[model samples]
Every structure is written in structure tokens, then in C-alpha cells.
Target: MLSALQLHSRGWRVSVFDSGSAGRESSWAGGGILSPILPWNYPEAVWQLSRRSLPLYDALAPELAEATGVDPELTASGAMLLDPDQIQAGAAWCAAAGLAAPEIDAILQTRGPSLPGLLLPWIGQIRNPRLGQALRLRLRQLGIALHENTPVTGWLRDGGRVAGVDTAAGEHRGDCVVLAAGAWSGALGALPVAPVRGQMLLLRAAPGRLKRIVLDGGRYLIPRRDGRILVGSTVESAGFDKRVTGAAREELLAFAVGLLGTEAAGQVETQWSGLRPGSADGIPYIGEHPALPGLWVNTGHYRNGLVMAPASAELLADLMEGKPTQLDAAAYRLGAGRL
Candidate 1:
């Protein structure tokens, strides 16, 4: 949808085809941390895309809310990293990236005292489901053709140069075709994308119980505006299985309770899972395909889809238009080393 919106805004006729309902897939299920969970852990490419995309939301959130009457709840609530070991590296990364240095703190009144953690006050988050809702509405408002519940069966090939997609309803021909199918991109072609299931649990807590996003180890606690705390997530290699297992529920609930104390033990509201497009490395492919002319790709975003969406869309648009890109487009090309 971001890609479609980007193209549409640039005076191009755009149509979005989804196998299921728009915004009900990975975009809705994500935790919506605007920045990478652990920026120090990801590659330079991931950070490059994230750094460029993060500021775009400051304007986008309000634009969506004003246009669609659905607030995405973009918040600068900041983030607390409990990993004391990464403080030095995190500080260095912040310095290099021109971001404010993290403040060293030992105690969060809500979660109690612990080893001193890094408090980054600039980190932002969005209510992801609401963002998805706003995007869908905005797409409609812009008069972009949105074909929901329509699965593209295959490519409408024109000899070597591609033309458009083949759908069950009929043939929807276009001058260019972009594969932005997320985890399902692997099934369509020789792409290196696959489904990696991640399960998340939501706990109904007091609105003020948890103030900031907390990251401990690989898991996180994202407190929403409506007193709902999102506890996520387990990274399992289980292919395409979005089942919310009891084990994952227990594990995520335990993690929530462990951080927020015993009062959070029975606050479980709901549990769900999403399939992220897992690539070998975290960097997504955001350029034209070398083998198929006029066939572009914007999949393989793995875990950072929401974080990198805006810049990814812009970068893909730049490549498609043969314009100078903001970041080095070579890093995200199809034949680039890591998919």
C-alpha cells in the first residue's frame, strides 16, 4: 500500500491487489516500533533505511488522521533498553547517527529497580492496526483502485518484458508490475523470502502502568494509548504457521509478568501471530528484478517492514522512475549479496 500510495502521489495510476483484506496482514500484526528494535544489532543498510524513514511519520500520521479520521497514535513515548551490555555500543551508534545519546538510568518506577539501562528519549511508536486502518482509508480517499480479496495468480507476461498480473477475476494489465507480497513473495518466484512466524500477546493493563516501550533480550512490551500492553514476540522458524500456540502464550505472558510484576499475570486480553517475510539478512530487496524487465520488487523486509516502509517506498519509486535515490540504491538491488 505504501508503494501504491507513493506511485499514486507521483501522478501515476495505481492499483493494490491483496490476497486478503488490505491492512489485515503483517502490517496490522506488527508491533509498530518506528525504529529498529536493537539498532546496534542490525546491518548498516537496515539503519540507513530506518533513519531516512523514521522522520516521515511525523508528518504522515497527522495527514492520515486529518484525511481519514483515524488516528494512528504516533507517539514519542521513547524506549528503554534493559540490555546493559549494549550501552556503550548503543551510545556510539547514536553519536555516529547524530541522535541524542541515551541517558543512563537504573530504575523505572513501574517495573522496579534493575541494572542501569539505556533510556533513549527520541524513540517513537505507532499503533500499527490504526495505522493500517488509516492507510486503507487514505488509499480510498486518493481514488487508488484497491482490489481486496483478489489474489494475483501469476504474471501477465509479454515475452521477455513483463506487462502485468494474472488474477482469478480477470487479467489486469499494467505497464509495470511490483511484487510487494510480503512473505508470500517466495511462492510466486525464485525469491529468497519465507514466512517466519512471530506470536504476540496483548495484556489489558492500566493506561499509566507502563509509560515507555521496554526491550529486554529479544522480547518487548509496547504500551498502547488505550491501556493495552502489547507483549511480544517469539521468533520461530516454523514456516507459514500462524497458529497461536499455548506455549507461546505462556511464554509471552510469563515475560510480561516477569517485567510488570504479578499483577500482570491474569491480564491477558488476546494472543495473535504474524508471518514476517524473513530474508537471509534483515535488509529488504527494493529495486527492479534483473531477470524480468519492468518487474520490480519491494519484499523481503523481514522484521523491519513498518520501520523501513516509507523510505523503501520512496527508494523503489526512485528506482522505478530512474531518478537519483536518497540512499545508495545498490545496497537494495535484487542481485545484491544478501537477499
Candidate 2:
């Protein structure tokens, strides 16, 4: 997206194709943790993406909001992760990373409903829906055409190079086809993008409620500035079925309410599910297609799509521009017959 925006700034005619409405997928569905509060459950590469892209938003977001006239709400209000024994481990992680540990809750507060936690001062978040809208607006303003509800059916080939993409609306021609189709990517027959379903809940909170994001174990609470808290997510390989089950919803609600009390219990305004495009290892696939020329990938971000967008775009932009990649593209390269 950052690259598309940059290229648009340079007067390149860019077009985006989505199987569904653009940006309505996990891009908008994410919890919007701009991150540093990321759990130790993630790998170093994931952490590296989080560490790098978290700060890039500061430089690019205002420009994007100004250019698109959309308020992609981004804020650095710090974060807190709790899990009793894990809290001490997290403290070491934060301190080792050179983040400012606020004296707000230095000692381990007795585990009330949830486990003990500490606020990681360098963390941040964004309103993902607002960002998707902002990017769509920006793309439109830049004269970028988008074909929503029309997805690539297959590839129309011409020997070594990819000729065009076949969609439900018939054949759409492009000099190059970049796959940003997210989870449905694996359905493309040649793309390595696989669907990883994640179910999340949107909760309307009481006034002056939870101050920071609280993530304990696998569950996370992403607080918006508008008093809405996004509690999510279950990572499951349930194919393309993006169904919101009663089990996940019940467990998530019980967890969040356990921390913030019963007042936030009846505040569940809505519930939904979306799929994160994951790879075999959870990093995004981002290089030239081994089978087809003039093709590249930008999917398989798993749950990190929103946080890694800027960096992912940068890597794609670098490759598309024939510039050297700062990160190793070896792992990201499409393997033989693996798309």
C-alpha cells in the first residue's frame, strides 16, 4: 500500500483487484496493534516487521490522511500484556528492547480477573477500518482503478511471461499481476497464499473504560479511541470457512469481561470473522513467481498484514523498482510449482 501510494505519487497508473470489496478483509478486520506489545509467541522476523513498520506509520500516516482526506486513526498510547509468570518475561523483553517502562504499574499487581501485566511504553495501534478507507480513497484519488467482487479466476499465459488474469467479469489485462488477494491466494492455483481463519469480536465499552491494549496469552484487547474494544482472535486452519462460532465468541467474551468486569459484558455490540492469509511459516511471500515471469506475491501475512503492510509494500516496491532488497527474499521466494 505504501509503495502503491508512492508510485501513485510518481504518476504510475495502479489498479487493485480484490475477490471481495477492497480492504474489507483482514486488512480492516485486524485488531490494529501497531505493536511492540506483541507476544513472545511470534518469531524474530515477525518481531522485526512489527519493530520496523510500527514506526513507519508516523512518517506516512499523516501524509496518507491528508492525501486521502480520511482519518486513519493511529496512536502510540503504550500497551500492557498479562499472564502472571509471563509478565516478568515480558518485562525483560521490553527493557531489552530499550522501550520506556512507565512507573504506572511497575510491581506485579495481584492477578485480579486476568494475569499480571506491564505497559510497554513504545507500543501503538491504528483504526484498521479507517486505514482501509483511507487507502481506498487515496488509490481512487490517484486514478487507480479497482475491480471489487471480481477476482482472478486463473492466469492467461503466453510462454515465459504472465499475459493477464482471468476473473469472474472476464479477462482483465495487465502488464504484470501482483497477488495481494490475501487468504484466497492459495485458491489461485499458483499462489502460495493459504487461508488462516481468525474469529474476532467488536465490543462497545463503557465511558473511560480500559486505557490500553491488554493481551494475555492468545487473546488480545485492542482499544479504539472511540471507546470501542476489539477482542479477538483464534488462529485456526479451518480452510476458507470464515465462520464465527459460538465457542470462540463465548470464550473471548468471558476472557475480556473477566478482566474489565461485568459492565463491559453486555457491551458486545457486534461479532464477526475474517481469514488471515498465512504461509507455511507465517511470513509474507514477497518475490517473483518461479513459474511465471512479471509476477510477484504479497500475501501470507497470517495475522500481521496490517502491521507489516508498509514494510511489505516497501519490499515489493524495491523489487518492482529493481532495487536491492534489505531483507533476504530467499525464504519469501516462490518455490518450484509452489506459486
Candidate 3:
């Protein structure tokens, strides 16, 4: 969606083909954290992408809201990292990133009594579904063709370049092609992408109870403005099976209860799952295919797709236009072997 929007803004005609409805997959299902849970843990590639994308989100949320008359409900709600190891690493990470490092007691007192943690005041989040809606609305306003429920069965190649795509309807050709097919990119052939199933639990808390986004252990709790807190998630290599298993639900509930106590966990509203497009390495494949000319790929962004989307699209647009980019574009090329 970002790619199409950017391309359209540049006076290029764009058409988006989704296997299902747009924003129905990982983009909608995610907790919408603008930054990674542990910013220090990921590789430089992830950091670079997130750094660029983060600022874009700050500008975009309100811009789209005003333009499309749909508020994405972005909030600088901040975050509480409730792990001793992460807390220990916080100062160094902050120093490296040139961010503030608050005292652990201050963080615990302000945001929690659960455990020792780190306070990140600059972090923000968005209501992802609303963001998607705003994007779709804006795209329509821009005259971009959105083909929902349109599945691209295969690519239409002319000589060595990608001519277009073969859909159920017919062949829809274009000047360039971007394969941001998400988890289903595996069906496009040897792309080293697979589906990683993640199950999430939504629980309701009183409006002022849970103050901010809390990352405890490996699980995260994202509090919404409507007193609904989203507790997630379990990263499992369950292939394309998006089924919400009882065991996973129970496990998530247990984790939520453990972190925020039983009172918060009892108000279970709903549970769901999404298949993230896991790449060969944790880093996403974001440049043109080495072997396939005129064929570009912007998928393979496993768990961090939402946080990485803006910069990924920006980098992709730079490459597509043969313009100078802020980040090293060659680092994300589709070469063999892992990062």
C-alpha cells in the first residue's frame, strides 16, 4: 500500500492486487508498535529501516487523517520494557542510539510495579486497521486501482523482464512490478519465504488501568484508547495454518495474567492469529531480484512488517526510480546465503 501510494504520488499509475482484502493479514493483526520491542536486539538493517520508517509514521498518521478524513489514532503512548536483561542493556542501547535512559525505579513507578524495566518516552503506536482504511481511502482518492480479492496466479514475463501478472480475471501488465505478496510469496517460487503463525489475545482493561505498552519476557501488551488492551503473541513455525489453537490461547492468557495480574486477564474479549512472512534471515529482502530483471520484491518482512513498511517502501521507491537513497540499498539484495 505504501509503495503504491508513493509511486502514485510520483505520477506513476499504480494497481494493487491483494490475494485477499488489503490490510486483512499481518498489517491489520499487528500491535502497531512503530518501533521494535527491543530496539537493541535487532540487526543494523532492521534498525536502519525502523529509524527511517518511524519518522514517516509521525508525519503520515495525521497527514492521512486530515486528507482522507479518517484518523489513524496514532499515539505516542510510550513503552515499558519489563525484562531484567533488557533493562540492564538499556543504558548502553540508549547511549548508542543517542536517546534518554531513565532510571529503572522511575519507569517501574510510572508505568508498573510488575518488574524492573526501561522507559522509552519517544515510542508511539497506531491503530493499524484505521491506518489501512485511511490508506485505501487516500489511494482511491488518488485514482489508484485497488483490486481486492484479486490473486496473482503467476507472473507474465516478456523476454527477461516481468511484463505483468496473470490473475483470475486476465493479464494486467504494467511498466514495473513489485511483489509485496506477504506470506503467500512462497507460492511465487524459491524466494526463501515461509509463513510464521502468531496468535494474539485481546483483553479489556479499565481506561486508566494499563498505562502504556509493556514488553515483558517475550510477550507484549498494547493498551488502546478504548480501554481495550491487546496482549500478544506467540511466534511459531506452524506453516500456513492460521488456526488459533487452544494451547496457544491458554499460553498467551497465562503470560498476560502473569505480567498484569489475573484481574486484567479475566476480561478476555477475543483471540486471533496471523501468518507473518518469515524470511530466510531475520532481515527482509527489499531490493530487485539479482537474477530477475525488472522484477522487484518488497516482501519477506517477517514479524516487523508494520514497523518496517515505510522505509522499506522508501528504499524500494529509490531503487525503482534509480535515485540516491539514505540507506545502503545493496545490503538487502536477493543474494543467496543468510545474513
Candidate 4:
């Protein structure tokens, strides 16, 4: 939808086709951390797209709320890293990236392990489901065709060049086609993408219980505006199975309770899972296909799709329009050693 929105704004007729209900998959299930959870751990390619995309939400969130009447609550709640070991590297990365150095011991209230933490006060998050809702509404208001539950089975070809998609309804001929199918992109061929299941739990806590996002031991706690704290997630190589497991639930509950104390034990509202488009490395493919002309791709985003959406859309749009891209486009091309 972000890609469609970008293209439509550039005077192009755009249509979005989804195999299932739009935005109900990974986009809806993701904890909307606007920045990479552990920024220093990721590659330069991920940061290139993320740093550019993060700031775009400041203008986008309000635009969507004003236009669609749904506030995709973009909050600058900041992020705290409880792992004391990574503090030095994190601080170094921040300095190199021209960001403010993380303030040590920024979080005052803690009931769990007494570990030192570094806080990046500029970190922001969005209510991803609300963002998805706003994007869908905004797309429809702009007259972009949204074919929800319409699966594109194959490509509509014209001689050697790809033309459009083959849907169950019929062939929807177009000038070009973009495979932005997320984790399912590998099924369409030409991308080394697979489904990696991640399960998350939501807990309804008091509004001021947790002040900001907290990361520890590969898991995170994201506090929402309406007193609902999101506890996530378990990274498992469980293929396409999105069924929430009892073990995952118990594990997440334990983690939440450990951090927020025993009071959080009964705050469990619901548990859900999402299939991220796991690439070999975390960098996503965001350019035209070398084999199929006029067939572009914007998939393989893996865990960072929500964070990288805007800049990924912008990069894809710039490439499609033959404009000079903001970042080095060569790094994200189809045959850029992603496999």
C-alpha cells in the first residue's frame, strides 16, 4: 500500500492486489518500532533505508489522520537497551550516524534485574494496525484500486517483457508489476525469501506502568497510548505456521512478568503471530528484476519492513520513474548477493 501510495502521488494509476485481506498479515502483526530495535547490529543497507524512512512518519502520520480520520499513533516513546554489553558499540554507532549519544541509566522505574541501560530518546513507534487502517482508507480516497482477497496466481506476459498479473478474477493488464507480497514472495519465484514466524502477546496495563519501549534478551515491550502494552516476540524458524503456541505464550508471559513485576501476570489480553519475509541477510530487495523486464520487486524486507516501508517505497518509485534515488540503488538491486 505504501508503494501504491507513492506511485499514485507521482501521477501513476496504481492498483494493489493482496492474496488475503490487505494489511492483515505482517503489517498488522508487527510492533511498529520506527527504528531498528538494535541499530548497531544491522548492516549499513538496513540503516540506509531505515534512517530515511523513520523521519517520513512525522509528516505522514498527521496527513493520514487528517485525511482518513484514523490516527496512526506515531509516538516518540524512545527506546531503552538493557544489555549493558552493547552500550559501547551502540554509542559508537550513534556518534558515527550523527545521532545523539544514548543517556545511561535513563529509566528510573524497574522491578526486574538491576541492569544498566542506555536510552535513545529519539526512537519512535507507531500503532501498526492503525497505520495499516489509515493507509487502506487513504488509498481508497485517492481512487487507487484495492483488490483485497484477490490472489495473483501468475504474470500476464507480453512477448518477453512482463505486463501485468494473472488473478483468479482475470488478467489485470498493467504497464508493470511489483511483487510486494512479503513472506510469500518466494512462491512467485526469483527471491530468496521465506516465512519466519514471530509470536507476540498483548497485555493491558495501566497507562504509566511502562514509560517507553524496552529491549532485553532479543525480546521487547512496546507500551501503547491506550494502556495496552505489547510484549513480543519469539523468532522461530517455524515456516508458515502462524498458530500461536502455548510454549510461546508461557515464555512471553514470563518475560513480561519478569520485567513489569507480578502485577503484569494477569494483564494478558491476546496472543498472535506474524510471518516475516526472512531473507538470508536482513536487507530487502528494492529494485527491478534482471530476468523479467518491467517486473519490479520490493519484498524480502524480513523484520524491518514496517520500519523501512516509506524509504523502500521511495527508492522503488525513484527507480521506476528513472529519477536519481536518495540512496545508492545498486546495493538493493535484484542480483546484489542477497541469497
lDDT of each: 0.87, 0.75, 0.84, 0.89
- Please list all clashing residue pairs in model 1, or write none if there are none: none
lDDT of 3: 0.84
Instruction: Report the C-alpha lDDT of model 2 over 1-339, residue by residue, as the tens digit.
Output: 555675566556677777787789888778888863354657676777666776678887897789888888898766776766666667777678777665435544525534446767677888888998888887877678877888778887877788778888888776777877788777774666778888888899754576777777778888888888889888888887977899988998998888778877788988888888887777778877776787777778887878888877777777777888766656566785444
Better of 3 and 4 by lDDT: 4
Per residue, candidate 3 scores C-alpha lDDT tens digits across 104-159 of: 77665633466567888777788898989999999888889999899999888899
Query: What's the alpha carbon RMSD for model 1?
Result: 1.5
Would you give me the overall lDDT of model 4?
0.89
lDDT score for residue 73 of model 3: 88
Each model's number of backbone clashes? Answer: 0, 0, 0, 0
Candidate 3: give the clashing pairs.
none
Off by over 4 Å in 3: 110-114
Candidate 4 residue runs with Cα over 4 Å from true position: 105-114
TM-score versus the correct structure, for each prediction? 0.97, 0.90, 0.96, 0.97
* Preferred candidate (TM-score higher): 2 or 3: 3
Top candidate when judged by lDDT against the true structure: 4
Least accurate 10 contiguous residues by lDDT in model 1: 105-114
